[model samples]
Target chain A: MEILNLEGTEDTPKIILDKKNGIFEISGRSLPEDSAEFYRPVLEWIEKYSSDSNPSTEFVFKLEYFNTASSKLILDVLSALEDIKGMKILWYFHEDDEDMEEAGQEFSELVEIPFEFKTY
Target chain B: MNFIYDLHRTMMSQKLILVFQGDFTQESTKSILSMAERNLDSSGEESSIKRKVFNVMVEALQNIVKHSDELVDGQVRSHAAIFLIGKEANRYSIMTGNPIRKENVVKLKGALDRINGLDKDGLKDLYKEIIKNTTISDKGGAGLGFVDMARKSGEKLEFEFPEMNEEYCFFCLKVNVPRDNE
Candidate 1:
């Protein structure tokens, strides 16, 4: 499968999904008006990636801000990865951003994926 | 008109940092967020406070864009809503107003009241429960906006629903983020 790379906009996040090079990260702002539409291809890509085998998959999410709508889509993204073996998530938050940290904690609780929270 | 100057005086007197009253689109909402962001940046507020204010603003503006009822009455256009930010001595208050169908008032009020009734932990639990059980609606809402706003502000959400007409009511919501420890 081809890489699903997207440039970040003012209201959307940058997405990089590469299974061959072992790069899977979603970063920056994520407050898109139509979050489901923006993330549709992402979910599709993840579903396809799950079928192929990887020794271990580490996904990174370094979001600066995301609205409530994006939160639901984000949960969907995490839940989609629940079935993958040897999958882990790295969630990053700013030191001063309790809300972002709490958001990561909440997502971790709602999904079976192992999440390691990191601060910058 | 003199009323224009009068309105300006009122805004100045109230210490309004920003005020927008017009039709809301996704594009317009993005612009509004960026403009408010710049204002907050230049205000020299702490990053934590700014983040809370910005988060609440995103939820408030997007709610208007998604759920505001169309006013078919004369002069009022569809998707029309109002957003205002006021800088007080120790807090920043974000306010929004939009038309909603009269029929939805009771349900919306119940949601807000329930949120207000919860403590911090209760709000957190409610947020988690809703996110776990609810699917994203076609409108892209998971019924989490009010709870998220309340959680971030660490304060009660203030609101009013004034009758706009026989069929609609203007829903007004206000959330305040403290600038200094109280």
Candidate 2:
């Protein structure tokens, strides 16, 4: 299986998708200028990963900040995992970051994936 | 000569903390966010309020980059825009202005008016509906920025479209985020 790892930048998030070690995570600021273009490969990878099997997948979204355009792309990322049966999401937010917490709650409500929110 | 001092007096009178006027690009947007983040951090702003302001700032700045008239007369204009942040006793006001095609003004105005008319629940529903249905444009816009800004700031978006010329107009938007949580 091919692993995907992208370093976080000043405006974009770091993404890691490794089935071998069972680590699927996206973290940091996500205000990329071209969000759709930025997330295309990530979506494609997730699509391919869905075809193959994993007993269980734990995806983490520990985003500190994301623009509205990135919000739609994030939703697309979640939707791409709809076919995976044993999918769980771990969302992390800062202690006083109500907006991030609410963002997690909203996403949990939108998708079928179960989410466990962690406060840092 | 004295115009610089006059401009400073005006900024001070308005309680303006930061102002940027130039062609807004992705690089400039990143710089603006970083500078504003530092300003808020130094002011001892609460985490929640700072996040709201930051979110609104991103949307406002990106809005300029995505919608402004970068092309005019088959030539690429500068995408010149202005951004301002004013610190007040009760709230932080974010304002942005950019040139837009005159023909597109009506549609943009209608969208803003609809957003202003909605309450909290209404805005939330609109946001959810858009995210569920709309496709991100090639320019990476989902038309969700204004709605997100309204929801985050918990205030009606103030706007205007003053005529700049026959084919273009100046689009201005202002959003105020309360300093203290209500």
Candidate 3:
């Protein structure tokens, strides 16, 4: 498995997926214009990772802000992760932003996989 | 001409305004929104104000990217549109306008009508419902963006569809944000 790294932008975020450590992190603002384009590779990588089966895969999402399109993509990412065995996802939300916290909780409810929400 | 000038002056007096014309792709929208964020951050504005401007700007620009009628080289472009942000007394106002296809007017009307009918609580429920039921469309028109915008703005979303031609119309939306002092 190979790692994926993308720099964060004013409207996007930095994505660091470390295949060696089995730790995937997406952090920063994410309002990508072509969210499909921006997220396609990450989703594909996760799909590939799911099949290969790491002992334990930890996914981290630390987003300051994201638009509606990005929100949908996030859901897609979570759903993809849910299919993988031994996958653990941790969603970090800013303490000051109730909206973001609620969004994480909402996603937890929708997906069957357990999602741990942590405030930073 | 004088009336136009007066209207411009009046708008200027309200708050900061940024307008975009031509192609408004995802990259361009990201740039514009980032610029706004940078400006607000440098100015040391209140978080509430910053969030309000950010939410409204995102919603308006995304709408343009998804729905604008004019296309340039196969890409959707903003046609005769304006985006304005103004602070009046203690409140901020965000407004946007763009040309729309006549065929899409009915759907746009339905979207806005559903948005307007919802109160904050109702909008929240609607957003959750839509998010759960609607498949993520390529064009980003799950109708949840408008609902989220309205809920965040804490203001009634206002819109208009003026007849422009046999095939197109002008659609406009205005949302207000109350300043912290208010």
Candidate 4:
């Protein structure tokens, strides 16, 4: 499958899924009216990529804010990464944004993947 | 109107700072959200507090856009809704009302009650459980909107059903998010 690239909107996130480069990232605010619909393809991409597997997959999430619906979709993404080998999730947040930091921690707990917390 | 004075006093006493009453398409609601964030920033609210208010506000607005009764019982409700944000010394309140079919009132109330009854840990478990067990509703709801609001605000969600007509009522929801000092 080709890499999935989507530009972020006011209520969506920027998505970059490149299996060859081993770069999987989704960042920005995700509060889409139809989050499930918006995230369907991303989840499918994860499903396809995990089968082939990458030696060092970097899954990065720098979501400033995401609604509860998007939160579920995010957790699903994290869970899918569990099937991949050499997985590392880099969770990034602003220095003063404790909520985002905590969200990173909470999400990391849902999947048994190596996680790194980065602050800007 | 005759009771206009009372209404003024009510808002003033509550420190109601922002009020928007009209149709809210998803596109228009984005601007309102931006304005609300600016209001919080200018007021010197803490970053976490602003995030909490912003999150709850987004949920409330989205709920209205998704669930408000544009038409109920063969009658159009005009798609107009009301949203207000109030700030006191240390707390912020977000209130929203929209037309809803009377039949949905009970279910919504029950959900709010269940959310209000949970502790922080309980809410977290419930959130994870629901997300794990269910997919989003056609309206893009995982049934976690109210739960997330309650969790972020760290307060019970308050709601009421004011009579609008026989078949539809104004479903009013109010949430209070108290700021946490780091």
Candidate 5:
């Protein structure tokens, strides 16, 4: 279980998945042209990580902006994380951005996993 | 006879105008945006104007990419569209048009109307609220893009939904950026 780090771009966001430390972070803008292609590897890594180790994963999502497609992909990631036991996901959002906070709540509602929302 | 001369005079007095017709997908929009950016940079335009132009362009391009209905080659290729960027006196205007479904016209019109009605402070509040409340729609109706454009331009967003057919309509949006200070 290694780590995955991607630099943020104007159209995409930085993704950090540290499997070793059981920390996952996605931050910045995410308006990718092809959401599926951009998120496939991240999804696959999460799937593999959940299956291999029952690590106490801490998922952090700090998105300034993301499109509709990216929203769906984020849901997929949340669902995958739910599959793993003893996983703790902390969804962080800016204090001013109630929309993102509500989005986290929505995702939490859909998943059976223990998801917490923290405002910064 | 006089009308023709007036038209010619108007054309001569107007700045360069370029119209892009068709469905502006992500790829094509990206190309056009990059072109606009480069052209503006080379023209030694003021940074403020450049930024406003880029912001308005991005918002308009994103709208077309996500919402336009008419498609070519079995995919929406920015056809049935008209994009115009030109200067009228000291103001720069960027306008984009696309064929929209009749079902979407009312909603889009309402959105634009609301956007146009807001002042700068109102728009800022609306943007903050929209960004915090609006659910990310599956088909690109978060409504933040328009607000962003309004904020960037420091001007009201103008739009029209003209009838095209029973099932579709022509949607046009115009954003203005004044260059007098620059």
Candidate 6:
């Protein structure tokens, strides 16, 4: 599939899903009014990429802020990757940001897969 | 209107950093959030606390837009909701009040009571359990916004429901967010 590059907005995140280039990332604030609607296509793309899973998928999420509504959708996106093998997840939080770090921990617990929490 | 001026004075004396009262459309909500960003910036608060305040504000304001009753006290126009963010020492308190349909009061009361009774870990467990058991509401909320707000603020939500009329009651909610080491 072709690259799925979506520019970030004030209330949404930037999405880059390029399987060929080995780039799968979502970053920025994700508090969209319609969380499900905003994340629908991203979920679809990730699922589509599962057909031919990469040897090892490293999905990075550098989120500044995301509300509860977006949290569920974030889980949806992560759940979509369960079928793929050799999938690695990187969750970034700011230094001393306990809330963000805890959020990553929660998401990780739900994922049933270990995630690398990198503090920047 | 002197009453309006008096209201401003009251908020000022109360150390409220931001106050808005009007119809809450999505467009207007964005402006209030941006104004909140600037208000927090001017206070020199840390970025983490600022983000927490913004998240609570977003959830609070959107709750109004989603559930506030249009005909307040049987009036034709929309009921104007009030949003206030006040800072006192290390505590940042967000207070919002709007008209809610009378019929839903009991349901809301039950939900709020359950939320208020939980400790930190209990709140976290309830949040995850609710997510697993409940579908997102038609309004696009996971019924977990209050839980998230409580978890983020590290405080139980304070709320009140004053009967405004036979058809409606004013629902007021307050979430207190703490700054560094507070």
lDDT of 3 by residue, B42-144 (tens): 8777875777678778878888877664544343356466666665656777778888777878987898888888787788788778877776576755557
The C-alpha stretches of model 5 lying farther than 4 A from their native spots are A7-10, A13-30, A34-120, B1-14, B70-78
Q: Candidate 2 on A17-66: residue-level lDDT in tens?
A: 99889999999999999999999989999988998859999999999999
Model 6: colliding residue pairs = none
lDDT tens digits by residue: candidate 5, B56-86: 7777777777766544335444567777787
Clash totals in order = 0, 0, 4, 0, 9, 0
Complex DockQ per candidate: 0.85, 0.86, 0.47, 0.73, 0.10, 0.64
Error of 2 at A42 (Å): 1.1
Residue-wise C-alpha lDDT for candidate 4, range A16-116, written one tens digit per residue: 99977766899999998778788999989988988887778888998888998899888888888887888899999989887788778877777799899
Supply the global lDDT for candidate 2: 0.90
10 residues in a row with least lDDT, candidate 2 chain B: B70-79
Worst 10 residues of 5 chain B by lDDT: B69-78
TM-score of decoy 6: 0.95
Q: What is the lDDT of residue A54 in candidate 2?
A: 91
Worst 10 residues of 1 chain B by lDDT: B69-78
On DockQ, who's better, 2 or 6? 2
Q: Interface Cα RMSD per model, in Å? A: 0.9, 0.7, 1.9, 1.2, 7.0, 1.4
In model 1, which runs have C-alpha deviations exceeding 4 angstroms?
Answer: B72-75
Off by over 4 Å in 4: B1-11, B73-78, B180-182
Q: Per-residue lDDT tens digits of candidate 5, residues A1-120?
A: 768889998778999988777668999877777666788889888877877865466778887666555666677777788778777778887776654675677667667778778877
Off by over 4 Å in 6: B69-79, B180-182
Highest-DockQ candidate: 2
Question: Is model 2 an incorrect, acceptable, medium or high docking prediction?
Answer: high
For model 4, give the RMSD to the true fold.
2.4
Task: For candidate 1, please provide the TM-score of chain A on its own.
Answer: 0.98
Interface RMSD of 3: 1.9
